[model samples]
Target: MASGKYLSILALTGLITTASFAQKSDADYGWVLDSSKRSVKNMPQQNEFLNNQYPYPSKPRSMWELGVSGGGSFIFSDIDPKFGFGGGLSLRKSLGHIFSVRGSYNGSINKGADYRLRNTYDGINGPWNGNYLIYGNKYVANYRTKVHQLSVDFIASLNTPSIYRGNPKTNIYLLAGYSILGADVDVDAVGSNGQPYNYTGINFEGKRSDIKSALKDKWDGEYESNGSIRNESRDAIGRSDKNWLIRHGLDLGAGIAFRVTDRVNIGIEQKFTMPFDDNLDAVKIGSANDFISATQFRLNFNIGNSSKNVLPLWWLNPNNYVYNEVNTPKHMKIPTPVLPDADGDGVTDQFDMEPNTPAGAAVDSHGTSRDTDGDGVPDYKDKEPLTARDCFPVDADGVGKCPEPPCCTELREKMMAKPACAITSLPSVQFKTGSLSLSATAKAVLNSVAQQMNANPECKVKLTGYYKGSDKRSMQLGWDRVNTVIKYLVEQQGIGEGRLIFSLSDGGDPNTVDLMGTTEEGPNSIPAPFPNLQKSK
Candidate 1:
């Protein structure tokens, strides 16, 4: 049973490790600026001669996080929960920019008490009265459990930086883990004289607070009796050892940390643990399981040589690669632009295949002399450049042997006709009031518009949304509708985003959008007019 429980802990740790490395292959994360080349493992001076795309940068061996924490703990069982003392030591390593694995060892002294007296037939979580008859006819519920635990926690950072941001100084994260729990639990059943506690003077008719006070005044504080231990839970794990019982526990926690310096940080954390077995409070009342809650303040230290390792990845933004390359050319290869139009041909010499051409002669896009007719002469020298195929054989002066054919006139005319395309009768798309959602009818209308744009590839569209007053809300709603339509057309209907123009019309119905063909040019999209309003899609 112990082996099976340990295997689960291994599986969870392995899964997190595998996912972290998967991102290392693709992310543009921060690389340690190690000019010394200790991490290169190759010739140090070779990096100076490398091109923009040479050996890939290596991930720096980052520093591990070590922390110590001390705080109050409480136990939840059948009786009322009371404050206790707990502290722990943890070692953590980052798996990726967002995920990390932490291992912690902790110890706590937990205590709880029940004020109500109970009999054999009493409920509300009362142990068997006959079993503890050696103590007294009526007894109160209480225990003091000293626990030791070791756990493996996985943490996910919520605010790891990406594009448009730099590294973070404060981190918020959530965590969950698996733990092995062991505790020694005991109850105060006997008086200071080493005999069963006598309950003759205790008043049963007072308020719960008053009754607890009376019980405390009449008895010694030392727990002299052994707490009731669950026979089955212990025997299943291992042989009984002293007052300690062992069980598998699950932990959930969250915390925030602030960087104090390059080597240190401070944080406050809270953790709750459930050990599955209900014997934590030294009671087997068969009512509920027991759990522990701890809230601690931490002082953490970074353990590594700062020259070799970067701060943990969770503090690094992954967009520094793009941001750096745009502003500087330190690691970039930029070819000098080659723009020389030789022979006055209008095409660059690098791309022009023909080195020389007659002055003022018409040429194709490639800068070669144009041969309008299929005859062997260039247009600048040929007298006739539009000879029909039937008149193919021409003289040296480029005059066709025969006139244009009468029977081929209609065929030539038909070939000269352009493709028929018209963006007529396109439907307008409507949106829900004060929303970004498109209705079924609006989608059907937009689909028709996409088909027309696909047929007439040369056509651009203007999508205009209406607004009431000139107030910010009215204008922003119009802008939102136009933006939504353009996104739908480009994303869902496979239309090019550049083909849709956004517009807004004042003093009209705020829920309607109009689509029309446009020959005028404008920006395809625009920024929102009032951004503080809620947004939806």
Candidate 2:
């Protein structure tokens, strides 16, 4: 029993040791793009560099596995009763992905009793003294129970999920292999004489000897033996048989694991195994053949950091708990007309031709819009929006017009046709009824003429003084009047001398006489004065 316990301990230790060394191969990590930044300074631009962007992260650590277990097993198809409790430990390690090695130890107690007849000549019996006491009577015989298999195995673990799982964590699995089973078996039995049938054919009286000799080697100071009983009529003890046992088996199991911390993890698993070869039962009782079966529960403490190795499945991984597909060209979203700021310009780029203009850019009342040309007229309406020269143009009379280079002839014709100065001032200057000073108001008008001539620099006027006359004196007075206007225009008024043109006489059709004094008549007395001095181009 002590030895079996020791074997279990050794198997567990071996499993741990063996599994600790298992590692994932580089191939298992799949392909990961190298992401190191380029160290070279400035280099010539090349098409290759244009296509290259960023690199993928590298695989970080090695992959490893460990496990422990305990359970009961039953041995079958053996002559000796094959029923017992058993338990063991197993460990598996992956060595660089594709290949791995594993080792384990298992122990069991297979107990059963055996019975048979041993005919011995000169076998001791009750003394025949004083009545010829018959010798051998059938005696009951028995053997003490024994156990088997301190076992160990070394095998390769195959079909692992660690590779594809990406996570160094482990999951449910099945393991199968062979084991090297070793054990010591001692069989003990007691023997006794049999009774005779017909008065003297066999000894009827018997002395059964206690068979202590069957006690062979002891484990932890306890006798190790297989018990047996001989023919039903015998009562006696028998010698013990000693031999070696070998175990071969199949292991099947599943387990789950989680990272307790970075490199360490705790795992719990249950396992069942089928032994293919006989254990100590075969050596003790030659005809005994048995198969071992066991169930076990274990806690696996693992030590290994997570691997940075990328797997084919890495594309599906999410860094966070929430997951979804992420697309790039980050800002390309469906556009809305109301929010025309497609480029995210505060000033909707649609209305603002210069979308990216600096803030506080000169604009129309709608603050976001821009004025590309600085002209008072905004670019939107200004024909020659950029030039200050495109202002309103004034005609000769100092009145403004819309079109450029306003038609001076059309404006002059319109004003002249009105008879403002033509009929009124011209006729009035020819005072028919009086002297050069016709009336105080008329004098004032003449004075205004003088002031106008004085103010005008490059202007010229023609003056023809006229009157109603029947004699030369009136005619002469008209001349005197012309002289009076000329004197004011050229000398007193400072009008340029070359500009004044003097004329005399009626200045109108002489045949048309002035119907002077009456309100209804004159030399075509249109309103106040005689008609003359019309402006001509």
Model 1: per-residue lDDT, tens digit, 1-537? 223533554465446444433343223433534544236654343364343345345455678999999987888788776678899999999987899999999999888877777543333222334445764556776778888999999999876765645666666788999999888777776677766566677777878788778877876868655566554533211113364677898999887776777688887677889998787876666757888888777899998887667777787765666567676756667799777766655555675667586655545445676665668787668776666677769889776777546899997666445323335345567666678898755664675567557756888898888877767878888888888889889999899878888888897678888888766687897778788863776
**Residue 126 miss distance in model 1 (angstroms):** 13
Q: Estimate each model's TM-score.
A: 0.53, 0.33
| Candidate 2 lDDT over residue span 178-214, tens digit each | 5555544433222122212112222223321212112
Q: Candidate 2: lDDT over CA atoms?
A: 0.37
| lDDT on C-alpha atoms for all candidate structures | 0.71, 0.37
Residue 398 in candidate 1, Cα distance off native in Å: 33
